[model samples]
Target: MIQKIPPGPVTMSDWNFVIVEYQGHVVEKFLGYYYELQHIRFSSQVIEYDPQSNTGKTWSGSKYFFLDRPGPLYPLAQIYLAHFSRNEGIRVRLKYQG
Candidate 1:
């Protein structure tokens, strides 16, 4: 389901209620307070979005990884609001079993 995030801060509690479903299956199930957003960076080819072509181009540089965020999991959602604010080209999707 595509959800629109309202303007304002998104608390951890709000993230807990967000169930990331893809292909009619639950992919990311938040674990209340236990779930945390982790960020990482490494040397790699950077991929930038080309709005004109609606495609990505890889450039030489360090790559940054923002993990456990909503934008990557739900790309259709508006990113200017709350947890959907990340505009980075790189992201990591992790399934927490804890």
Candidate 2:
């Protein structure tokens, strides 16, 4: 299911919820959290990304895996939001790799 992020500041982490692009559509999946200084194992499901609308369909029961382990998606920022804050997550931008 696509977990809609609330309107506020947020951060990305390993095994955390992520929205990525796939086949010309944006998808939300739970692979691994952001660890170290790069995003690794971007292998998971690619739901559907609709920037114009705020709606989601049922699960498509599909999965995709990317072998690009270029480290964390974003760099550690100097500050972070409360909702976006985590024990392991650092203050950084949320990057979606399709």
How well is each residue in 12-70 modelled by candidate 2, as lDDT tens digits? 34233355443566645444433332442233443542334422222443232223332
Show model 2 residue runs off by greater than 4 Å: 1-13, 33-40, 46-98
Where's the lowest-lDDT run of ten residues in candidate 2?
74-83
Look at candidate 1 and tell me the lDDT of residue 2: 34
Q: lDDT of each prediction vs. the true structure?
A: 0.27, 0.34
**TM-score computed on alpha carbons, candidate 2:** 0.23
Stretches off by above 4 angstroms in model 1 are 1-5, 13-21, 24-94
By lDDT, the best candidate is 2
In model 1, the worst 10-residue window by lDDT is 34-43
TM-score, cand. 1: 0.18
Candidate 1 lDDT for residue 3: 34
